[model samples]
Target: MKNMTLERITEVCGGVYYGSEADKKKEIAGAVIDSRQVESGYLFIAVKGEKVDGHQFIPQVFEKGALAVLSEQELSEPAGPYIRVESTLGAMKKLAAYYRRSLDIKVVGITGSVGKTSTKEMIASVLSQKYNVLKTEGNFNNEIGLPLTIFKIREQHEVAVLEMGISEFGEMHRLAEMAYPDICVITNIGLCHLENLLTRDGILKAKTESFEHLTPEGTAVLNGDDDKLCEKKMVNGKPAVFYGIGKEAKLAKTEQGEKYLAEKEVYATDVEPVGLDGTKAVIHIGAESFAVTIPIAGEHNVYNALAAVCVAGKLGLSVDEMKRGIESVKTIGGRSNLIHKGGMTIIDDCYNANPVSMKASIDVLAAAPGRKIAVLGDMGELGENEQELHAMVGEHFEGKGIDALFAAGALSENLAQAVGKCSKETEVHYFKTKDELMEELLPYVKSGDTVLVKASHFMGFPEVVGQLTK
Candidate 1:
C-alpha cells in the first residue's frame, strides 16, 4: 500500500486516466477485485467471472468509497475515477507487475509439477529467519491469483516467496512476468496437467518458463534426483544449482554431511534424517555447515527444505537463522496437513492430487500410528494414461499396508476395482458423489483412526474432509 497513488498506479499500469485531475494524484490504500472488500481510496478491478460480472458492482464499489475502478466497459453511473481497458483481468495483472517493480524486495519464484506450494512455504520459512517475508497464500499460484498475491506486498516485506503454477504452455511466462524473481526453484517435473501438456517433457517446458523473466544474476535451484529435471544443459548460460540424493549433484548427500564443491558449487551426499514428523538435514555450503529441520511430513519435504537452505545461504542467512526458519515452517492447509479432531487423525490433503503425490500421501498414511484409511477421489487432466495411473495408485494402496480405501468419481471406480483385484480383504468402496461418500464413511471411521483425504480440486474431496472433522 505504500506509494500507491492513483497517478503512480496509472503510470505503472499504462492505463488511460479518465477522471478528476485532483483525484488522479490521490493515493489508493489498497487494490481489490471484489466489490465487497472495497474500502475508501481502494482501487477496484471489475473482473468478469463465469457467474458474476464485476462491472455490475462498479457503482456499488464507488458508493463504498472506492477511489477508482478498472473496467472493460464504461459505466453509465457517475463514478469518481475509472480506468477503461480491454480486459480488467489483464489490466490488473499489468498493474501488479508494475507494482512489483517498485518494491526493493528479493523475490523467490517456485514452480514444478509437484511440491511447488510446499517448497514455497519452506523457502519462505527459511527466509523469514532473517527477513520479514511475504509469501503466496493457499492456491494463489495461478495467473489471476499470482497477481493478487503480488498485490499483498507492503513496505515492511523484505522478501517475497511466490509459487507459480501452470496447467498449459505460456501460463508460467505470464506468472514470471509478475514475479521477476531473484531466485527460481523448480521442485520436480511429473505427470500432471497432461490433458493440455501432453507429455512429461511438455510439463517440464511449461514449468521452466519461470526462468524467462528471472533476474540476470538470479540463481536456479533444481532437483538433481528427478530424472527429467537432471538432464538440463544450461539455463541462460548459467549452470543451475542441483540438490538431491545423487552423488553427481552440485549439492550431494554424504554420510558425514552435505558436500559442496567450489568449482561446481555442487551440494554432495550428506547424512540427513527424514521422518514422517519432519526432516533434519545438514547442508554443507563451502566450509560452513548448516543443519535444518522442517515441520512438514514426507521425504520430498527434505529436498524442499534443502532447496530452501541453499537459497537462504545464497541470500547470506547465517547457519542458526536458516535452522530456525526451516524448523518454523508449517504445512499449508490441505497440503499434507495433519489435523486431529473427534479422536480421528485426518490428513487434509484434498486440495489436489496426482500419481506422484498420491503415492507420497500413501507413504505418510503408512507411517501414521493408527489404522490407515484412504479416502481418495479422481485425479483430473491426466490425458491418455488416466485409468492406468489410477489403477497404479490402487496397486500401491494394496501393497502399502492400507487398512481400507474409499474412492469417488468415475476414475476412482477403476482404483477401487484395481485394489479389490489384489486384496479381497482390503475394503474398497467407490462413491459417485461426495455426499454419498460422506454418508457412507461415518459408520466405517472410528476414534483414533488415521484418515487420508486426497483428490484433485474439482473432485470436491475437501467437503468430505469437513464432514469427517465435524
Candidate 2:
C-alpha cells in the first residue's frame, strides 16, 4: 500500500478523481474486486463480470467503509470518493503494475502446461527459509488472478512466488508485464491446453512468453529433461539455468534422429521413491551437493524441488536452508494430497488432470500395497484429438497392473474401452455420469485398497474425493 494514495492511484489508472482535495493524499490499505472483501481503507475495483456487474455493488462497498471505488462509469450521487476510468479491469492491471514497481521485491514467476501451482508452492517454501515469501494461493494464476496476487504483496514481503497459468497465446505476456519477475521458472511442456495451444511446440512458445518480461538482469530456470525446453540454451541475453534428474539431459533431436547432450546446472541424483512418504534424493547445486527428503509424493515433485533449489541458489540461500525447505514442503489439498480413511488409502489428486498427470497418478497408485483402483473422469480442453488423448491415457493405464478401473463421463468411455481391449487381469467399468459412478463406487472397493481419483476441474472430481473419504 506504499505510495498508493488516491492521487497516485488516479494518475496510475488514468482516471479522473472525484473527491475532496484533502482526501486525495489518503492511501488505501488494500485493493479488492469483490464488494464483500472491502474494508475501512480498501479500494474497490468495480469489474463488470459476465453474470453480475460490479457497478451495482459500488454503493454497497462504500457503505462497508471502503475508502474509494474504481468505476468505469461516472457517479453523481453521494460517495466518499471515486476514480472513474474507461475500464475497471484494465485500470486494475495498471494500478497493480505501478504498485509492483514501487516495492523492492524479488519475484519468481512460475508457468508451464502443468505443475505451475505445485511448483510455485515449492519455490515459496524454499525462499521462505531465507526471506519473507508470499505466494499465489489456490488456482489464482490467470489474467485476473495474477494481478490480484501481485496486489497482495506488501513491504513486509521480500520475495513473491507467483504462479502464471494460461490457456491460449499471449496470456503469459500480459501476466508477465505486471510481474516483471527477477526469476522466471517453467515446470515443463506437456499435453495441456491443447484446445487453444495445438501441440507441444506451441505450448513451449506460449509458456516461454514469460521470459520476455523478465528484468534485464533476470535469470530463467528451466527443466532440462524436457526436450522442448532443453532446446533453449539461452534466455534474456544469458545462458538459461537448467535443472533436472541427471547431470545431462537429451537435447533437441537432429535430422538423423540423434540427440545432443547438455549439462544441468542444478540437478538431482539417486532419486529413491519412498512410496506414500514422498521421495529421497541428492540435489547438486553448483559444486556442492546435499541429501534431501521431499515430503511430497511423486517423482515429478523432485523436479519442482530442483527448480526451487535453482531459484534459491540464485537468491543466495545456503545448502542446509534449501534442504530443510524441500523437506518441509506439504501437499496441497487437490494436488497430490494423501489421505487415509475408512481403511483405505486415497490419493486426492482430483483438482485437475491431463494425460501426463493421469499416468503419473497411476504410477503412484501402482506403488501401493493393496489392489490399485483407478477412478478416473474426463479431461477437458483436449482440442480435436480429445478421443485419441483419452484413449492414450487408457493405453497407458492398461499395463500398469491396476486391479480395476471405474471411469465416468462420456470421454472416459474411450479410456474404459481401451483398458477393456488390452487387459484381461483388470476389470473395466464405464458410466455415463458421475452420479452413476458414485452409486457403484462404494460397494466395489474393499478395505486396504489404494484408490486414485483424477480428472479436469470441470468434472467436479473433488465431490468424488469427498464421497470416497466420507
Model 2 C-alpha lDDT per residue in residues 1-470, reported as the tens digit of each score: 89999999999989999999988999999899989989899999999999999999988888899999999988878478999999899998898778888999999999987788889889888889999999999988887988888889999999999999999999888899999999999988899899899988899999999888999999999988877788789997899999998896565664347676457999999999888788899999989999999987788999999999999999999999999898889888989898898899989999999988988888887777788899999999988999998998888866678999999999999999988887767899899999999999988887899889999999999998998888
Where is model 2 more than 4 Å wrong at Cα? 251-258
TM-score per model over all chains: 0.91, 0.97
Error of 1 at 181 (Å): 1.0
In the range 306-364, model 1's lDDT, one tens digit per residue, is 78877987899987887787788888679988888988899999899999999888887
**Alpha-carbon lDDT of model 1:** 0.82
Residue 296 accuracy (lDDT) in model 2: 75
Indicate which candidate wins on lDDT.
2
lDDT of each: 0.82, 0.90
